[model samples]
Target chain A: MPRHAPIELEKFVPYQLSIVSNTVSEDIAREYRERFDLGTTEWRVMAVLARYDGDGLSARAVARLTAMDKVAISRALARLVANGRVLRRTHRGDKRRSVLRLSAEGWRIHDVVAPLARQHERAFLERLDADEQRALARILDKLLATDAAVR
Target chain B: MPRHAPIELEKFVPYQLSIVSNTVSEDIAREYRERFDLGTTEWRVMAVLARYDGDGLSARAVARLTAMDKVAISRALARLVANGRVLRRTHRGDKRRSVLRLSAEGWRIHDVVAPLARQHERAFLERLDADEQRALARILDKLLATDAAVR
Candidate 1:
């Protein structure tokens, strides 16, 4: 008789974490839709440009910040371009590479979303006191920085 | 001049954690692709059923376990049924409700994946030490158990 397979539901920490995260993200996406009329990726792009500093990173930086795929970011940026939420301009001396920036509407969206995002965060982290939230963020960032551990 | 958008990234601890979780899940998905012939959902479904009771839950339960949508799970279970990875049968009294259980091959796949999933988790959580892993798991489970906090 073969051994009974282990229960994966509670055993895999990563899967559990992902489940919680996805649930939280879906809530955020739904809330964002209600407030901003933007897709998840579109809002993510604007959020990235809100952090943009004329670094010419385009969709690459957005993906880095949001943990989205390059293809997904590219598609989101294309939509932004179509909707005039983002602008793509030639770099000062580089033709092949284009620098992407937020347009006026993108800024408007970001402005509207920032406070709501903060409130959402507050609601989600309400169970955790400030110190606990800070501690969790520190630990998560440390884990994220350790490539060998995660890789 | 438009006002500079507020910091979107720093506003939410849960949002940041979700992005970190996405990073880890993507890493796990990449690892699975390199080692298994199964797609992401296929691997997840098998894993979900590995520990599930043979009493057979509805496809919705499986979807919740796998974090997959009902339509997607519908399609995947259809494929799994055709491939003999799963047994989809209606209850004796109720034919409209389909109950799902793992077939032998599904069990085999689950056996193969358990260690791989654990390896990925052990490596990722190694940074936090065993005690910290337990702590993190407890906190995450608490959050997940809170229905309003989840999504």
Candidate 2:
């Protein structure tokens, strides 16, 4: 191609963000994957259920909050149930739909993984100072606006 | 789980970043996947090849640059070659290794896609102000430093 300027692959912002995301994900994935045999999707479900303390959430709600499709949420829910980490219960008002909550085992896993997850984030953020951390958070908010609007 | 504090899934920085990364990737992937019939890996290979001007790069180098494993690089290279967008040649000095470069057709695709890629970035960044953009870049640099050091 006759080009005025070649795109600098290294400096590309999307590419750089992707690399960071992948690296961080792989690092965290290895931890849960090995110890708990949890895939990324499963971990997300576990995290979500662990967040709420009461009657639990519907599959649709989990799908919406996680940005995962219904099919994926279904599959992960199945796996979580099979592993005895989450309980699929009949929804209080809607008998046809089931709400999901963490089982005792699920809570145990979440309690352990939560601290590890925080540790990972802490180490990762240690790379930047307080000002940079604030700046990063602000930047992410702004960047995510386009994503939120489009959705 | 009886918890000291539950990890807030929504407020977690890593999870937020993953959402943004996945959204941005999906947005870009749809453009090339529908129009160019290029999967993300194949497009990444094409972009890397399109960046260099001359003799081309080894598959090992491509893997390193792309953050993909050798097997993934090989698969992408095969698809690229089959589609007539890339040429694989035996290295001049080392017969054991092969170098890859974009063909004329590859350049055509790259030229077409580069602007689309840039447009996506511009549109995404427009959500942020100049200062936020600068901070984003700075944060990415800091985040990447740990990755580079570990590698």
Evaluate all candidate structures by whole-model CA lDDT and list the values in order: 0.74, 0.84
Candidate 2 residue A69 Cα shift, in angstroms, is 1.2
User: Model 1, which residues run further than 4 Å from truth?
Assistant: A55-69, A148-151, B1-5, B8-12, B33-35, B64-68, B148-151
Query: CAPRI band of model 1?
Result: medium
Candidate 2: which stretches are off by over 4 Å?
A1-4, B1-4
Best by lDDT: 2
* Isolated chain A TM-score, each model: 0.81, 0.93
True contacts kept of 2: 0.62
Candidate 1 residue-wise lDDT, A19-137, digit = tens: 77777677778887887667887887787787865665656667887767889988888888898888888778767666888888878777877777777767777766666666666
